[model samples]
Target chain A: MKKILSLGLLCTTILLSQAQAASTPTVSGVFEKTVHAFAENHAPLGQIPASDLLNQPVAGIDEETGFLKVQTPKGLVLVARAAVTTTMTAAAPRETSCSYIGTLAASGTGSSSGFASNCKAGAR
Target chain B: MMVMFWIVYKFFDPLSLESATKNSSAQFFSAITAPFYGLSSPRSHQRVAVVTINDPTLQQFDAALPLSYQRQVFILRQILEADPAAVFVDFRMAYEHTDESLSLFQSVLDEAKSKHIPIFFARGEEGQDQIHLLPPLRNVESYSNALETSSAYPLLFEEGNAALKEDEPSQEETRKPEANAAFDVYRSLCTSTWSGQCGSFHEDDFRRPMMIQWGLHVDPAQTQVSSLANSPRNICAVPFSGGFFCRSIVQSFTLGFRAFWGSSRDYEVGHAYYPLTIGAHQLGERGLGTPAGSPPLSHLLKGRAVFYGTDIRDQHDDTVLPFLGRVPNVVLHAMAFDNLVTYGNHYFHEPSEVEFGHGVHIGQAEICEFILWLIFTGWMAFKFYYSHPEVPRGHGAKLRHDIRRKSRDFLSLSLSVNALVPAIFCAALAAFDLSHQPTLLNGMDEALLYVCLFLVLLGTLVLLRRSAQRSQPEEAEHAHGPEESEAEKAEKFRLGFWAHLALLTSLTAIVFALNELFIQWPNADWIGFILLWLAVGESCESTGFVLTFVNFLNRRSHALTSERVPNSESSSQ
Candidate 1:
């Protein structure tokens, strides 16, 4: 039981860490540059809040994946992602269904080009 | 630094329903209006015809004699006596009577011609193919003598569409869904009768959404429903204009019922049309007749008509109307009889009905979709966080088999171009809709938002997916086990942090280009170049980030699986 619990805790820690990295607001000295970039392109209401989770906090953590949870006070239900980068796309709305996404990555870092397509938000 | 590579890989995650529905808002219109399938509009005509008085005066003891016989005779007599523009006796003569009144009804048709009344007989639509119009039993009259006998079709709904042009008299085309038609059939039926009510049916937004779909307006609020014994059980003759009423064949119902119960009969309700209660009774005890005795038949018949036919053993349409299958023909006549007294047929819809059917989509589809997306994303993150790493399940892989048995079909199943299914579908839909909308600069700029979102979601998810597919031996630099050396954990974090930075830079560049080049800002050239440089930097950094994350997850999963089977497999979800 202790082993199982620790394993669970470790996994949770890794996941939370990744989520936090993902959503961590940039602290800058480089802040002016990041804000300038955001202000230059952002459209009003044109931006859809996209996420692998409902509330993304730790974003750039490796070994982090998906989860299912419901928000209280307002019963906003989130589906359990139950997946990692490699296994996420296996679901399609069956019991463990993920969203109707095509794949886990469209243009992540593996491209042979100089820049990542879009999935490199944490690699800045 | 290792985190840099992982961040770039996270940009490739698949989308969720919450995201898809939010992004695709235009389809909601069609989905919202799909349920107006029931409101049919029978063309109302301008012809005044015969009236069959269904006064209780004719019943033997006011005890409603198996009204199967006298009803036809009474209808025939009225046709003969009214010698009006035309005569329509809505009695179903096809019915079987112990003392057959078939000849008597036929004799009355003969009398109508002999008396010089332009006469017509009606049949329910489903029965039209079979109804043979007999030359009036005594076709010895002339048109100059006011005696042209005619055949009429019984239908339902008035104020539906412009009358079918003479060239297109067939009813098939008229039977399509017409929510966009000129006069709202449901609305006209409700407001035309001088009834006290105003707005047509609408479900309450707070409580109910599915609107009650009954064609006519019967207020459960106003009328005191009689005792179940005395509940108004009557067949109704709804005002279906084109000089006839829709006749429902009860024999069809009985035949169908018997078929289900191992008893077959020849009964059919060929296209029965029901009424829209406009709150006024035109031919009732308190019907359209004025105090001075003039029949309010003009206003009543303005949008109304009449119908009559043979109620036979095996001739019913038995159509399961959209919401509910209904009264057999016999019961329908009885119901129509009851329509004469206590309550008026006014058009109204309960609040609950409309909301379920139409309002919710109009009111909440977007918000619901967005919220659903957020919840789904959060859950995914949570699941991944909680489900991995063994924490040294004290017991070892020795308790379970090391080589996890995989279905032979797994590789063949997902690899057969099926893996390309989503991308292909997405490309098709994206290209298809984009082609239709005029491409605007602003819209191009908006692509930046999508890029940013997809990058963040994809980078992390892609790493997870790849690691899940590969074995651990080749997965170096991964923090594989709960007791993984701190060196591995540090390596994982270092890899992840850099990947995130690399991705953030690339996205910021693309967005900059999008805003400048696509959105056509004055500084577009400079912004685009800056974005282009950032994109290059991020891309280079992204490769390393993705490789590291994927490698780590792959090694971890393989190590865990090799160490324990059921624990890893079952706990994966």
Candidate 2:
């Protein structure tokens, strides 16, 4: 009974860890406006939804492609280097209100979405 | 003989032979206007500025096509803000457009109109004589008051028309009806948005078609363009006046463009032009900030007459000029405009009667001067041969010797005179060309005429010498008798020939050097100057020849006398 409980506990820990890995890390800091967003072919995709981008987690940038990886409700979005206009600001954690005003395009290959914004990052 | 020669020369059109020869008379004109190497008339400097829509500027837009209407509006706004003297947009704007783009474009046009800035748009013909603005823009008449159409037509007659009788009024009348009827046919054939005439516009509900004006005028102070107004219509209209007979004349679009923008300099007595050029990329760089490394557009464009057109390599706007092979159409327009405003069209007389007369009078003066030259040269040749005939030298041996010596002198004199004629003529022509005033004849024609005269003189001299020789058998035999051997006689002839040839060559060199030096002297009579030099050269050559011959004779006599004295003294001893 002790061995079975220990095995169950191990399985539960692994599953929890997997679940944690699947859930994206919450990105803090102010959201900035976007400048331009485009697909791989450079076709302009209009404005991306503010709610979709506000609390989305950044999944690190791809070094080779220079794309910004962001986790959204839909899927993992890759913003091309050319499309990305906004830089992330690391600030003291506070209620930040941001507004974006640039282009957004779907990321083609591995990423499910892409966006380029130049939003105002400020403490509300 | 002179009359006959003149008749043959004038009527047979010997000057026209210049076309067949490799060294054509046209080459002389070509050299003067040669773009790279030829003399640049002060007028060649940029007078009008051309803004070209180049490849890089096109690339800045999406899909690298012609500028979208929005971009055009932006560009137009920037240009209008710069406040040029006039703006000529050499693009068609007669097409269906998006409502938004049309409204935007209309607003820009309105702004330009309100500014009182003369903005001219290019008018083009659609399929089967249909007149329309170039595709995608509409409601042109609502926005702009004036439209620009091309006056460019075939200036030269085709082969079929060459056989038509010049004086046949019936044929001319027939041609007139055909010509007059064609414009209506053309109007019917073509469809247009303006609902007015293809080449005309409505002025206060009265439709007036465009006229072919003789010249245009731009006020230097106000920069206002005006056509030759109130001129008699159909006065200079030939059957080939591009099918527009008795039409009220107005300045061509290019001419009007030039009057406003062309840069001019007072070169000597007349004006010379330098066409201004600007690139579209530079304009875009200044306004939109796309392409890098362009000059600030404002500095070049402000208070300038700006012309905008497409100059892409494969866009087919290239034209061939006299020496400047294929150049962009805008450049051609600039050149033509410069030619009209600065030089005025000497060939066509739309400018004024006085201006046309001035050109004709200059031509007449040149013809008169050529005739005088021919007469004087002919008289000089006649006098030269007749005035200095050898006097009879008493009897037998002495007379024969004198005749032989005179013949040798005549040969040298003839050679020098013949060579001098052409050398002087060439020098005179070069000097005339370089003068501030226009040249009457080109260098090659002058050279050809002089060379022909020299050949005639040479032939006459040869015939005269042969006849004189034929008549003097006794003198010839005595002259060739035992005093000189055949080989020695042959040697003397060879030496005389070489000496004559050397003199000719030296004279040619001297004349060339003089030509270069005297090329810039104003109002100098080159003909009289050359004649004076020729006379001086002939006198000097004759004096030098006489002195040398006398010295040679004295040496020979002294040697013979000394040898004879020694032989006698030895015999007596």
Candidate 3:
């Protein structure tokens, strides 16, 4: 009974968080996408979620070469070399998935704390 | 508890582990490339801020390098490890930064997009009449908005000038406006990706494009990478928008002094890395070891994760910085990337709140305060014991007193408990010993000592007045009061006692002040040693009344002559 109650509470919390994150943002730029570009080459594999990339920083990219690299408990590894990346637009102009959530400000993720959710609001 | 939480949240948090590890390593590379930078935060949390128009209509002005959303995911995934808070791309879809070798960017964009980034061509902005106009964006309703918010990125608008210009600023013009030089803005478009990845590539990337962290916990490497065709030159050449990444948050490295100081100017900015010269002394260099045969990938991954990035200077051509002038483009990337991480934390906050990276800077203020309080307390304790010796003290008193006497040059601990002047001088010498920036705690300690000085001075004056009153014959000749007579003698003794204390204090103040300003230590380790010395000296116990006052808390014993006084002994008064 306790487990079920907690699960219900968690679900409600997630829904509430998503509702709050769906508001329109002023001057939206690509925040989460940028984090994705950042995390694409830095963070290690297996544990992290695709949604949480913006919340984490894994490594640094060489400005000239654009190679992304990270250090694990063992040593530093170059995850990806420098590359030209992209941004997006909505063809139908409907409620965007987290991708177009930047200009198309919608709801945030309810998985983490307030700041993490708030981070999604202004994302491009 | 809050502080502990913050520490755990930033450093040891399980959620940020993989990404944090990546950022910390990137920071290390940045550190190696630019050893001169004094960052507000550590290497991992380096920041990149991008400012640009987001409307698609504005992107129609020129060609945008074709980029995709899947690629964006691949790229943003890596940069997230360095702990960057924000990766702002200034433009809607037109973007990126420099050097003659545009091939590197071409390849990076291609690989990133092919993997998973979502991208599309310039979309025409819709008017109420359903007609496409000058700006081809679908998000906002107006064209004036795009024009008002952004200027041409430096990358797209560069003047490839061959000559370097140097208009030297006069000595006093430190914050000169002309410090910024003219540069070009480049334009390119990023491909699209899924919801989690699309918003990252802003057009300011053409010049001052804000970068995001790029490590993906998922194997973005195995994912097929794509390119932005809009980027005319780099469609599929350079892999991974060149070695770029950002992390979520770089934790602060708040440094503090280990102990009270000694003297030394051992931590000068360039000098720490190179022991090039110490006064007339010169040091040699450590060279790289001989090259070895390349190891297999499996062997390389045995104990260490192999990181590959170009740290070498541009063998092809040098790049130009707006203000600093020509240098290697690779170094520029290294320096700029390093600088971004270093100075990143300095922003997103008020000036007063920004830390100036004083991690390695040691100053006189901290040492002065720590030493003075320590010495003054020790001496005061000793004097209290001296004024009333018949009061029982401890066996350690004699040993402490003897050591103090031997250490001093002129004053005898037995006759004069005023060790303030010598101790301060010694402490001042110690304060000069610090080579590392003292923490805020040290600064607070120093402030407390300042209050101590003021109180001590005021107390001295009161003692002086008491002595004068006791010396007056009228006060001494009071026949009706035995208590008053004894008080008169006590007052006189106290006056003499305070005068000695005051003199010692003044001398200490002078020594600390002088050492802080004029004398720079010639060595680093010596400074640490000196601070330790001063702290030790100050911590020593005073063998007089003050020591007894503290010891009284632990045990109680009072005897004027070898015998304890009973309650009836004081009834005569």
Candidate 4:
């Protein structure tokens, strides 16, 4: 009973961690990337999502103001270039059954019957 | 065997193992001791700043080699405007420029000279022979651009050695041999940055090539997964990334064992410290030079050694640092200079050759290692041969008799205790000895000292407890057990001599080979020390100092052999 409880707790903890990791948004590159602004004390001020830059990329800079021009939900917005930071997050590899099958085949088992059975079961 | 081991150790250089071992070991030491680096939290060196002509800067200027002289002038003017302590230009001007362009570049040099902001231009070596500044532009200083293989950078390069030999004597050439740009900048700025401790300008005071004690700077904002993905280069490459808390927690698990052999390229940049870097484009931005209310550039560049070098992505001018991976030439130069400024000539030196009075010279590390080897061997001999009694008559003679009855009985709990206690004690002592100057101890040194001291205290306590427990006189008469006869004892003694010799010789050979292979390697010394401790422990066990482990193995093997033979007649056949 204790073992089962521990196993359940481990699984729940893993799930919660995964959820927390997923919630945090990641951005790459210094130009035309989605950026969230922070206040002077590093408080969350507002976010300039990639969609605001037409979901593609824009390098429009207001020369006088030194602000990056972006189209927000309400209207056009200009964000301070210095305030915006490009936070690079590592991309986790998503493993699927297809990749797993590839790995097994790559091991040189030379067993056609097993491969066929696995393929028939839609394991790919 | 001891003499043979020493001879092999002394002459062994089959592979260029010295530098290779030291480089790998230094990297490992840097990584495992990284947490201690954070004890003095902000490891971002404030004295040096890298102003990189990055990909964006190159694109913005549309610059290409034989880089236009105008761009060089612009960059110099921009840097000088911010009032840098010194500027090291890691760019080589290979192509001849027009008269107008040369004058423009020369004017900037004039400006730098006027402001007392010493600027050093990159002088060529080996491959790029054509790299020479125009006569008009050679108003300021020049430094050798040659990079050494190791993480440690050599400051002084004798003129005849490299590109400086054939070159016409310039006004910048001094009585002292040509120093690297890093050293020149440090020499110029150190007096003010580090007042009296920097010492006089005497030639003998400086240790030629110094290993950089890489810093561990953990910017909390960079801890996010997104930041890691984008710019993973600057973060400490350890498993946990909660910064100081994570390091402190993981450090406890490693203990002193991880000190000798650490994770290796993978561990190359594990310390995760890079100098504060700004793009050339950023520094040249108009608003940065505005002298109104403490501009960011002013704060960043003022009195700081600025390295102006190109960091173009596919550029060939790059060098690999043990703790910083492959960085631009300027970054390496900046880091070397930063080390000099911060430590003030107190950097790691290559194992110096020790002279023994009558012109006999040997490596300092080698002599110490040999002495240690000799001491260990002597101890082994004493334990294995001298300490053990001929007839086994003592308070613990029954235990010794039991060991003889069945060799498996040699593996006693006391043997393990004896082994571990000495091993721990020796490791603590070695760690303490490694950092000889306690007063000049950095974060890593302090960490090692603390951990080793703690272990030493713990080992002492364990020894005391064991000695106290052993003092009780139980089974006094039966201690010298009447087990084996006189003839059997004589036969055992005859055989034991050869057996012990073979065992000790083999153990010493293996330890010596490992030490040679990893002499300079990161934890190699630690690993070597631990092995020696174990060797000592094993010898102690052989002297009937509680041999439970060896005894168990012997007993298990005996039982297995006996079981294999179903009948005695069949077994005999």
lDDT of 1 by residue, B1-573 (tens): 123322232223234322232212212211111111121211211222212222212211121323434444543453344333334333333344554434555666667557544344332223123232233422221110000011011122222432333554465365432111011222223334312332333312111111212222221111111111111111221222112111111222233243334321112211122221211111212221123333322223232222232222223411122112322232232222222111122211111112555444222322332344345334432323322354343333322222222322233344433335434433443344345333322233233333433444355334433433443333443435345432332233222444545444444434433332233221211222222233333222224443344445656566665474334332222
Stretches of candidate 4 off by over 4 Å are A1-124, B6-24, B35-44, B94-104, B125-151, B158-174, B191-201, B218-272, B286-299, B355-361, B388-452, B456-573
- i-RMS for every candidate: 34.5, 24.1, 25.0, 20.1
DockQ, all models: 0.00, 0.02, 0.01, 0.01
What are the per-model C-alpha RMSD values against the true structure? 39.5, 23.8, 28.2, 20.5
Cα RMSD for candidate 4?
A: 20.5
Error of 4 at B213 (Å): 0.8
Q: Which one wins by lDDT: 1 or 2? A: 2
lDDT of 3 at B84: 25
Top TM-score prediction, candidate number: 4
* DockQ winner, 1 or 4: 4
**lDDT tens digits, residue span B1-573, model 2:** 333333343436465431222122112222222212111223222234556565534533222344555556666776787776456665666664443344556767788768765555654421123243532332231111111221222122222533334544454443311111112212221223212312342221111222111111111211101011112221211111222322111212222233223211111111111244444434423322213443345445565456666656446554432111234554444444344222222211111112246464323323443565466445433332222213222454354457657865665465566456555654565455456323322333333433444454454445545444444564467564665432232223222333444444344334433432342111112222233223322321323332244334445465564453332221111
Interface RMSD of 1: 34.5
lDDT of each: 0.28, 0.36, 0.27, 0.48
| Window of ten residues with lowest summed lDDT in model 1 chain B | B143-152
Quote model 2's TM-score. 0.35
For candidate 4, lDDT tens digit of each residue in A20-123?
A: 65654322223323445433334444766644534322234566544545444454455554323323232222111111110001111221101011123333
| Candidate 3 per-residue lDDT over residues B1-573, each given as its tens digit | 122222343336458643344333323222221211231122221122111111221121111223333333333333222222222121123232231222333443454345432212221111212232112222111111110011111122122321112432355244211101111000111222111222444423323322211111111111111111222212111222322121111111101111111111112100110000000000001111212332211111111111111111222223322111222222222223332233231211111112348764323423443454446545644543343334455655665556544543233233223335434544553354232322322233333334444455444544544444444555447434454332232333343545545645444444433433343211121222232233222222333332233335323333431254233122112
lDDT of 2: 0.36
